[model samples]
Target: MRLRIRPASRLQGAHRVPGDKSLSHRALLFAALAEGTSRLSGWLPAADCEATLRCVRALGIPVERLGPGDLCVHGRGLQGLRAPIAPLDCGGSGTTMRLLMGILAGFPFPSILTGNAQLSRRPMERVAEPLRRMGAEVHTTDGHAPVFVRGGALRGLRYRLPMASAQVKSALLLAGLYAEGPTTVIEPAPSRDHTERLLAAMGATLERDGEGVTVHPGPRLRPLDLHLPGDPSSAAFLLAAAVLIPGSAVRIPGVLLNPTRLGFVEALQAMGAPVAVAVEGEIAGEPVGTLTACAADRLGPLEVSGPLVPRMIDEFPIFAVVATQAEGTTRVRDAAELRVKESDRIAALAAELRRMGARIEEHPDGFTVHGPTALRGAVVHSHGDHRLAMALAVAGLVAEGGTTVEDAGCIGDSFPGFVETLQALGAEVEALEDPPRP
Candidate 1:
């Protein structure tokens, strides 16, 4: 698929993005482990979340779709999940595979998890190693996917993460629920706490002490009702488009305002972007709020590193787009993890942005962008990454001519209605079938 985007003088409107992806994934998994039926409202019905839903149903859990973003998961209890008759195909979702490994580690059954070519290249040892320490036999193909986990007796152990990862931390914590004793994870920096928050809401015995989190083994989880807020990562693209185009103003309602996920918003404000956040309320222990962004005359340079990297890790691709319109150099460091994503985002962003005439440099850990450059539209590739596809589309909105992003159908992985949403905000964008090679 190809997405052609033309320069838009302004984007103006009020929009509401889909439910938070991270929360949506956890909600389904937690619901499947609860003792009774769990009702979820505003769940993200994207490709990635669908991979999780498929896996749970394969495990004998009954999941019903009440509406577009509404679901009711009839859990099979912690020890009630039946062994699957076939291998679990996780599609392209790393979150589904890693978190599911944790859950399977506690079950006394053998399970094999696999994915597509992209996900197959992603390392699974970050999760497999910890589960191994807890007495689960886990094997991977050269540290990549096609993970084979043989469940047995699990004994909780204290482990310190080599790096900060919400997925890895959540995996360990989830596996801890089936261990013989308390499982504790110490992080070098704080990652997203959606897992810890949702677990606590489900009546799991867990505690957060500074950089360390501990989870106690439980026989069952209490099902509860939840309403997920709009994803902050998805909201970043709308906010970025609003600020970069002159005379543009966008209001995004019911966005998740989790402090851990607000680094991008903070970076925008510090760079002099006209952005405001108002807290509305809390649902399922996560903050909910509204974000309003308007066009700005100029944006200043900003530096991001260390603890801040994990907080805004998923937003860097779009942040690179915003930097191109800023006044000075924006430096991002300590984000080497970008290399292991669906695409090597550092290399992908640097190469594609350069094609659009942006002054950018790539590094092992991060990238640097020198801005206020006059960009001209050129063809770019999505490299099968959802975030990269959306960020490139944002770049096209400010370019002088039409920009076509190749293989953009991958956007369905996270944001299913991304193009439609952009069109609603007055952007000239369309999805077209890619032309065949001569």
Candidate 2:
């Protein structure tokens, strides 16, 4: 698939993005572990979340699609999940495979977890090593996927995370639910807390004190209805478009405003982008709100590092695009995690953006962008990465000529209606099926 984007005068309007992908994945998984039917509205029905749904059903959990982005998951209780007859294929979702590994570790059954080529390369040992410590027999091909697990008696242990990863922490917590004692995860820095928040909302016995979170073995989880907010990550590209294009103003409604996930928005504000937030309320312990962004007269370069990296880890690709139009230099450090994503994002971003005339330098941990460069359109590759595809498209909006993105079908992995949403905001973008190869 190819996406052709042309320079646009402006992007102006209001739009709502898909449900928060992170929350959607957690909602479905947690719902399946509850004691009764759990209703979820505004769930992201993207490829990634679908992988979780498939795996949940494979475990004998009945999941019914009530409507578009709506679902009712019949909870199978903590001990009710049955052994699957076949290997669980997680497709390209690392979240599905990693978090599910934690849950599968507690079940007294053997299970195999695998995914597509991209996921197969992602390191699963971060998850497997900890599960092994809890008495689950976990094996992986090298450090990658095709993770095999044989459930056994689990004894909770206090483990300090080597790296700050929400998936790793969530996996331990989920496995903790079945351990003989309390399972505690001590983090050097905080990661996204969707797993912690949702678990607590479902009546799991969990506690958070500073950098440590502990979960006690729970008898059962209480099912609850939830309405998820629009994904802030998905909303990020649109917000960037509004900030970079002259005369552009956009209002995005009902976006997840979890403080842990607002690093990107905060970065934009730091760089002089007119970004504002109006808190709507809280749902299932996660904050919900509307975000408004407008083009800035001048955007100064900013520094991104430390604890902020985990908060906006997924947003850096687009952040690189925004940096190209800002004054001075933007430095991003302490984001080595980018190396292990769907693609090596730091390298991919530097290479692809350079094709479009941006001054970017790749580093071991992150990258540096020197900006206010006059960008010209050029063909860029997605490397089968969805976020890179969207970020490249946003770059196209500001380039001098038509920009083409190859292998863009992968965008469906996270943001299904990305192109349509951009068009609605007045961007000249078109999606082509099987365009002639060069």
Candidate 3:
């Protein structure tokens, strides 16, 4: 797929993005572990979340698809999962693979998990090593996927995470549910807490002790009956479009306003983008809100590091686009984790953005952008990364000429209606099937 975008005067309207992907994954998995039928609304219908749904079904959980964003899961309690006859394929979702390892660790059977080529390259040792400490027989293929786990008796572990990872933390907590004692995970800095929030709402015994979360075994998780909030990460691209294009104003309502996930919005504000946030209420123990962003006359530079890196990690690709139009240098560091995503985001962002005439430098950990330079349209590639595809599209909205983004089909992995939403907001963008090679 290819996305051809032309410069837009402005973007306007109240557009709601898809349900939070992170929350969507946790909801389905947690509901599958509960005792009764769980009805979930506003669930994400993207490729990644679909992978989790498929894995849950393979594990003998019955799920009914009521709508595009709704589901009914019949859970059979903590130890109810039946062993799969074949290996469970997770598609391209790291969350599905890591979280499943934790859940499968306590069952008295063996299961193998595999994924697509991209996922197979992602390191699973971070998750596999800890599951091993808890007495689960876990083996990874040279620290990658095609992981094997044999469930059995387990003991709780007090493991301190070497880095901040919500996936790793959630995996351990999920495994803790079946262990003989309390399992605690300590974080270097807080990551997204969707797993913790959902676990507590489902009646799990969860404890929070400054940078640490402990989940004790033995509580029956209650079924979730709640509507999930929109993904803030997805909303970031739209908001960045508004901020970059002159005379633009856009609003997104009912977005997940978790502090750990709002770093992108905060970064925009620091860079002088006129972004407004209002907390309306809570859903499933996570804060929900509306966000309004308008065009900024000029955006200042931003310097990101430390704890803030993980919060806005996913948005850096789009943020790199915004940085191109800022008045000064925008530097990002401590985000070496970006290297291990579906693509090496640091190199991809730097390479693709530079193709569009931005002055940028790639670093081993992050990148540096010196901007306020006029951008000219050029053909760019998504590197098979969804966020990179969307970010490049936003850059197209402000560039001088038509911008073509190649291999953009990956955008459906997270934001399904990305092109349509931008067009509805009055951005001149079109999606087309790529021409055959001669």
Candidate 4:
């Protein structure tokens, strides 16, 4: 795909982008697990969430899309799903694979879960090992995808994650749905808690204590009324665009600010991006706010290291590029999780960011990008990573001339309107069909 961008005129106003992707997934899944209808507004109609919707619907949840980005679900209630006639395919969504495995663990029959090639290659052992300990019959290909979940009969226990993973945490918590007693999940390094919050909202007994959280099942869940907030992760791109362009300020309205998920915002602010939280409010227990991203001076090179990596793991590639405009070196570590995200993001980002003239070093876990480089446009590959593709496209916005992204179609998996949204903010972005290869 060819991206043609020139000097962009400044953006001076606010724009509302799409709803939170994380909330969208949880809303659908939690609603499916609840006992009645869940009315949700502001769902992102992107591919990943749709993949979740599809999988749940296969198990008897009536997920209805009411126009663009709005959905109403007829929930199955806890333990209400009948066995699916086929193996549910999540198709590149680990969110569906891991989370659903937990939900299915307590049902009366057997359920099999699978994903597309990329997701299938991801480590399911994170969830499999923990659920195995909980007395749930779970099997994987040594530790990867194609997990088979045998339902009925479970024992809840305390399990601390060896790593910080919302997926893993959510899996154990979901299994706690039908466990004999309280199922405790202690994450030494915390991950996103949208699952916990949404579960609690739906009448699931979930509580947090410091770095740990616990969930208890057998309580009847109230049907949800979901009004999704804006996706901060989605807005991060346009925010970066507005900040990079001099004399620009773009305001994203009503974004979710669940504490564990706000690492990207904190990282950018720490690096000196002029960002502010505005329009603060609460909807269904998740904090909602608007983010103001403005053009600013050079940012100090920073470290996106440590336990925070899992919270903002999906945003690291673009965060790395944004690091390029800052002075000093940006160290991204403990993010070995990136190796399995959609693609091997660490290697993919290091290799493709190099195509755009970024100075960087790579480790098995993560990469360090030494920035303040004058980036130039060149041919780059997405390696089939959605965020990496969009991150590289963002780099093209400031490159001399522009850049061409191979397999740019991957962006559709997450932020579907990424090109259009940035273009509206005065970033000259054009998407072309991938040209013929030699």
Candidate 5:
């Protein structure tokens, strides 16, 4: 697919992105492990979350879709999931693959997990190693996908994370649910705590001591009545578009305001972008809020590193778009983790934005953008990454002409209504069928 983005005069209006993708994936999985029926509202219906949904069904859980983002998952208690009759296809979702490996590690059965080409290339050993510590026999194809797991009795574990990863942490927590005794995970820095929040809300006993989080096994997780907030990562694109185009103003409501996920918003504010956040209430132990961003007269440079990297890890692509318009150089360090995402985001961001005429210097860990440079519209590619596709679209809004992003169908992986939201905000973004080639 191709997305044609014409420069917009300004973006204006209030719009909401999809429900939190991380929370959505965890909600489905946690719901499936509960002792009763779990009703989830505002769950993401995108391709990534669908992989988790499909896997749970394949494991004998019955889920009913009441509406577009509403689901009723009849959880089959922690020890009740049946063995899958076939291999579980995880699509292009590493979250689904990794988290399921943790859950499946506790069952007394064997399961094979597979994915598409992109997901197949992603390393799974980070998750596999910890599951192995708990006595689950896990085998990976060269530390990548086509993961095989033979579940059995698990012993409690005490492992410190080499890197801060919400996915890896969540996997260990889920696996800990079936372990004998307490499973403790220590983090070097804080990552998103959605899994811990959701697990605690579902009646799991979680003990927190600074960077160490321990999950005590044996509680029957209760069903959840959840109303998830909008995705902060997805909301970053629209808010960024508002900040980039002069005279633009936009509001995104009901977004998850987890402190760990607000690094992008904080960075934008520090760069002199007119971004404001207001906490509205709490939902299922997670904060829900609204974010408003307006075009700034000038944006300063950004230098982000240390603990903040993991907070906004998923938002770097769109944040890079915002950085292109900031005065002086914007440097991103401590984000080598970007290399292993759906695509090598640092390299991909630098290459595609350079095509639009932004001056970028790519590095092994991250990249630096010497910006306030004029961008000219040019055709780019998404590298089959959803975040990169959306970021490129935002960049097109401020470029001199039309920007075409090829292989952009992957936007549906997270933000399905992205184009429609841009249109609602008065941006001219159209999804076109790609031209055939010889």
Candidate 6:
């Protein structure tokens, strides 16, 4: 699972990416929990999302396929999800794990949730500790997965989030759907609200007050028909590729522009990249737009801190790759959340980038990059993180020699067809199935 990508002319094209991963997870899960049939189109048919569909189906909800990328979810409604006989394996999806905890807490079943080794390492305590506050019997493998959430009586309580985490916030909100009383969660800053958006679209009553969000229980969730927009996080790699090579212009059509997810686009603009966001329309009350980027001068180091950190959580790795080509230094702090992702991203990014000769330092929370850099080809590992794989691909696009990435397939968990999309835009990539190492 090694990939070789060589430098080419400006990575150029007008392309549409796969559906947003965050939205797809919440959409299907909520659809299964709502009353009647909910039809979903433009779904991301990837490993992680498919895992959600499978696990929910295992919980006794009948989910049928309409097409390759479409699904019809037959929900058992707010109080009707059947408990699975075995453990609920989430594969490598944290969204499935966290949000499911929130959802399962509403049901009165004792269940176990687990995932792959990579996901097993992620912090489940973020959701575990909160759901416990709502009066659900929740436990975890210390701070990691193998979480047992015994669904029973729940009372929604006001929660102040310790970090800027949409998954944690959304989990609390989703669980709130089943509480006899109202549930509210406050974030220090805004995180993605696709959960709130989808919840409202499904006829659930949800309101935002200041930095906190509240949802009332016993609201009937109606059926929904949706066209999910492309994921900007997945599209960030191509946009980064276009910027690294001069004379490149690429248009990404119909991507989600939720304020919670647009921090990456803003960072590129601040770095002087030629970036344009065209409002195409709206999907499920979330802003949908096309993002265009062109090659530009070196990006300057950035200060990624405070409120801006949560909005761009998923894009930080590629942002780090982009930062390597920028002048000066970039410091990213107040994002200790990075440590809880598929891997210790801050440390992994710094280690892998240093392997390619970038001067970077890792901190407990985040990292700093010293750049306006030049990278030579190197053997890099993805640490089984999808974003890491995508970041390495960008590293190859701007490196002196072609870079070889092991575990490139990890990107399929979030961004399926990632290699094909980049190759279609003239990137030189060869997918190789190298022999397994001892």
Task: Name the weakest run of 10 consecutive residues (lDDT summed) in model 3.
Answer: 77-86
Candidate 4 C-alpha lDDT tens digits along 38-101: 8999888888888898888899888877887878898877877878999998888888888898
Candidate 6, residues 1-438: lDDT per residue as tens digits?
788988777777899999999989988998888889989999999999988988999899998898968999988888768889999999999889999999898877899999999899888898999898888999999888899998788898899998878889889998898887889998888888888988898899988888888999888898778889999899888888898888888999999988888899999998888888888799888999999999986577788899899889999899998889889988899989898788889989999999899989999889988887788889999998889988988898888887899888888898888888888888898889979779
Full candidate order by lDDT, most accurate first: 2, 1, 3, 5, 6, 4
Q: For residues 240-301, write the lDDT of model 2, one tens digit per residue.
A: 99999999999999999999899999999999999998998999999999999999999999
Per-candidate TM-scores read: 0.98, 0.99, 0.99, 0.96, 0.99, 0.98
Q: Which ten residues in a row have the lowest lDDT in candidate 5?
A: 429-438
Model 2 score (lDDT) = 0.95
Query: Model 5, range 1-438, lDDT digits (tens) per residue?
Result: 899999999888999889999999999999999999999999999999999999999999999999989999999888879899999999999999999999999988999999999999898999999999999999999999999998789999999999999989999999999999999999998999999998999999999998899999999999999988999999999889999999999999999999999999999999998999999999989989999999999999999998999999999999888888899999999999999999999999999999999999999999999989889999999999999999999999999988999999999999999999999999899999877888
Question: What is the clash tally of candidate 4?
Answer: 1
Runs of candidate 3 exceeding 4 Å displacement? 435-438
Clashing pairs in 5: none
Candidate that scores best on lDDT? 2
List per-prediction Cα lDDT, in the order shown.
0.94, 0.95, 0.94, 0.82, 0.94, 0.88
Question: With candidate 3 superimposed using the best TM-score fit, by how many Å does residue 378's alpha carbon deviate from the native?
Answer: 0.9
Tell me the tens digit of each residue's lDDT in model 1 across 332-367. Answer: 999999999999999999999999999999999999
Per-residue accuracy of model 3 over 1-438 as CA lDDT, tens digit each: 999999999898999999999999999999999999999999999999999999999999999999999899999998778899899999999999999999999988989999999999898999999999999999999999999999788899999999899999999999999999999999998899999989999999999999899999998999879798999999999999999988999999999999999999999999999999999999989989999999999899999999999899899999999999999899999999999999999999999999999999989999999989899999999998999999999999999999999999999999999999999999999999988889
| Global Cα RMSD, each model | 1.1, 1.2, 1.0, 1.7, 1.0, 1.2
Model 4 TM: 0.96
Task: Spell out the clash pairs found in candidate 1.
Answer: none
lDDT of 6 at 103: 88
Candidate 2 vs 6: which has more lDDT? 2
